[model samples]
Target: MRAELLKPGVRPREVWAWAAFDFANSGYTTVVLTAVFNAYFVSVVAGDADWATFVWTCVIALSNAASLLAMPVIGAVADARAEKKKWLFAMTVLCIAATAGLAFAGPGTIVWASLMIVLSNLAYNVGETLNSAFLPEIAPESSLGKVSGWGWAFGYCGGLVTLGASLLVVTQGESFGLTFDQCVAGTMLITAFVFALASTPLFLWLKERSVPRVNAGSSTDSSGTITGAVAESFREVTRTLKALPRYRDFATLALCGFLYQCGVSVVITLSAVYASAVMGFETADTIFMVFLVNITAAIGAFLFGYVQDAIGHKRALAITLLVWLAMIVVACLAETRGMFWAAANLAGLAMGSSQSAGRAMVGVLAPKARLAEFYSFWNMALWVAAIVGPLSYGAVTWMTGNDHRMAIAVTGLFFAAALLALMPLNLDRGRRAAEAAD
Candidate 1:
């Protein structure tokens, strides 16, 4: 089956170009969202630990909610006009600009910093949605898992590189006559530049593959007025939502994805905070730990990419979720730094596997004509989880008097629920439905 689906003459350069976008954007995920900026925002910018937890969660929830509402509409428009690359490029620029602006956010600039985070995160999420939609275009069905895995692997490497650079600036800034705050600000500029430089190949080399479809309710004409295009996009989005129930398997998968990401998002967003609050890890220690996670995550992504193709995406995802469940348990029980480090590595393995397998599943299940729209739905699940996960964690932590372990324990329940949700998904049926639509 794999051999039959493989396209003999697919251009390798285009495949690398497509994967390069992942490599590009991961700098922001690592430096800003995961490692440096988030902790900085909470500890320095907000100036109160309890207040910072609540505010950070609120900011993340609000930003993710906005992106959730906007992505499907933007995706519909991009799909209608066959302009995925164009939309991707626009969002990329928005993300880079916002990330760069973070350099100006100092200790007394909470509002400014919060605004930058919201805008940069929104652009990053939307850009990622567009990027994932391109998978089916560049890779054959047989190789979707492998290609997605390669992209994730590249992303981890990119994170590692950028984080390593940030670590240097952070740990050695005093030697170079820069203060801690100045070094943190320098990392933001580094993130922006690395993202812009790494993403160049994607815009220049990858071509949009989908053609505009003829429809009365939606304008496929790229030359049409902007207002008309936007209106048509909204119409298409409404139509898709109404029609979603018929795609039961896809809907089930999306639900499962949302539940799983509830756990994943919380961990990704708050790991540094957890380490600092629970285990008393300092800035350099947290950075080094994240560096270790990225290394293992890259290895896990590369290995699990082939595993999913061999065993099936659904099975592979379930396995990853189980790993995630164990990770949460480990975090809950670990009282020592060594024990927490072990759990962190487990998280790295699950993170890479689940992400690679989940994206592959979406590529396999989505109708070719509406790939972007379906990925928009996928992004919606992620954003929704982003909202629910952090808010829930924040509430729990607040109620428990900043007990991060208890908050992390709650995430385990989300993983358990996600595994149960996956029980109802019929991957074969979903694949058949996608093929029939095609």
Candidate 2:
């Protein structure tokens, strides 16, 4: 099936190009969202821990909420036309430009910095929504699992390379004679470059697949009117929900995603802080920890990609969640840096697996025509979790005064809940039911 996507076709090159898109944009998620830039945000740019947490929380909450609100309407428009690629390109441009502009922001005007964060997040989420829809068009069913995993694998690797480079510049700031702020700003510029350059292949190579008519709950926007489409989109959501019971596996997986992804985000968001403030680890070692985790994540993506193919998405996700729970327990018990390293690796192992397979599961369960709409729901679930994780972490840290123990314990509960939610999805039974329906 992947062989077909790679061969001569209207979208052969396009398929590969679309896969590269993940590699391109992963820098933002890795460098900015979770690792270096986020570290910089809390430690330097914002400088105040409480203020930093508040800003991070606000930007994340707003951006994700915007992504949730706008996604369905945007997706419905694309799915109703042959212009998914165009919208994707446009959103990519928006993200890149906004991220590039981050180079200009410095130690003043908190509003500007916060705005940049929100805009950057908006672009990232928009790109994700459209990029996901492209997969079903390119990869056939037989190769979808591997192809999806490969794309994610590349993304993790890309994140690793950028993260390593960012750390190098950060560590060598004095010898290079640049201020720490300048070095940190350089990451945003570098982020923009890698994202833009990596994404060029997809823009040049992938042909746009023809869009089909609106699916069950979607509507047309031929009049180019926002008010009308917005009204209809609300109606569509209502209809999608009323009919959602039929897609039980999909709904359950979404709930699982909400819970576990929150756990994942909380850990990633607070890792550096946890190391520095709670465990008394140094900045360099913290960055190294992040680098190590990403490396492990790259491996995990491949290993679990295979696992998903063999055992199916539900079982694979469940196992990963179980592993996540164990990692949190280890975090609670660990007394030194060595133990934390072990926990980080364990987390990396589950991170990509849950994400890659979760997306694949949605692709498999959704109606083909409504793929974009369903992905909107998937993206929404992620944002809902995203909102909860960081805020909850901040609250736990504030209340318990033991960032290490309290944060890990709270996140562990989320993972445990996710595992419980995933239990009913017996792969064989689901396969039989799907087949029977067909």
Q: What's the TM-score of each model vs. the native? A: 0.96, 0.92
The positional error of residue 221 in candidate 2, measured at the CA in angstroms, is: 4.5
Clash pairs (backbone) in predicted model 2: 14-206
Q: Cα lDDT of model 1 overall?
A: 0.86
Best by lDDT: 1
Candidate 2 residues lying further than 4 Å off, grouped into runs, are 1-13, 214-222, 401-404, 426-438
Poorest stretch of ten by lDDT in candidate 2: 1-10
TM value for model 2: 0.92
Residue runs of model 1 more than 4 Å from their true location after superposition: 1-9, 216-231
lDDT of each: 0.86, 0.76
* Per-residue lDDT of model 1, residues 238-279, tens digit only: 776776776788888888999999888888888888888889
